[model samples]
Target: MSDTAATSSRRLPPANGATLGAMFVAGAVATMAFDLWGQILSPGLGWATLSPHGLARSLLGRFGLPNGDFAGYFVHFYLVGLLGYPLGWLLVFRPAWRAVIGAGGPWILPAALYGLALWVFAIGGITAIAGLPFFLDFTGITWVALIGHVLYGIVLVAVLRRFRLG
Candidate 1:
């Protein structure tokens, strides 16, 4: 067989339940940590808004739902699990994708990329919908969010790697 045929014939593995679970759990943990980090610093800095929790609250209020920390928590968990599942599956089971991710040397590098992607989406998509500012202000909250996202990615990848999940 030709090299092209050989390469094309390679099949990717399907993600098992455990791998998916790991991804969701990792995402939850990371998001929780990120939120906690924001909460910790929010008191000191005036007008400092940390994380997407505020956005979630705003969205819930607009929708006439009971808007508060509960809304934020619900939305946060929803997004984390929703996004994490597919990302973990692709990172683990897709050969071409796996190769690209692995090429980054340390797993954290790819995880950082993932975090950046999430931040961009959250800032651009979620914040816009929630009527929140989207990376427009250079504030302490913004800086903390950036760092938090990076940490989220690092932790997510580390957890996945540790469990050999994806």
Candidate 2:
């Protein structure tokens, strides 16, 4: 077969359809986290802002972070942001098998760590260690975001190397 044909007929990476579906689920969960924060947590803090952005800003203020008005959390902080990353890769780069397996493995673990770190830092001041429970109330969501972020990050690495996305 010619080089053009071989390139055109190349197969996909090993990451399964379910993994992709899970990625979408993770994204949805992230969005829900933002919603819950906006509706419930922000009001409790007297932030009174009903937007996701508002919730993040209020939380930053609550913790004394310099990142007021920051929007990167949607990508790094929330499960929805988690989803956005994978969804973007799945759609844009069309990940491959080697990339999927190698990247997907560690993706879930580290992403979760990062997500928790962000949360703890965000609320470390006002809540104290005792305040962790309230923030951690969304266990299911936390898992999703963390895992999703992991997958997203790994997939991003994979995509960058595999698909040549700049």
Candidate 1 lDDT for residue 127: 70
Give each model's whole-structure lDDT: 0.63, 0.44
* Candidate number achieving the greatest TM-score relative to the actual structure: 1
Please, what are the lDDT tens digits per residue for candidate 1 over residues 3-67? 87575444232357875676677777776667666666554555455756667788778778888
Candidate 1, which segments miss by more than 4 Å at Cα? 1-13, 41-51, 61-68, 81-104
Per-model RMSD to reference: 4.4, 11.4
Best by lDDT: 1
Q: What TM-score, over all chains together, does every model reach?
A: 0.70, 0.31
Worst 10 residues of 1 by lDDT: 85-94
Of candidate 2, the 10-residue stretch with the lowest lDDT total is: 122-131
Model 2 gets an lDDT of 0.44
Cα TM-score of candidate 2: 0.31
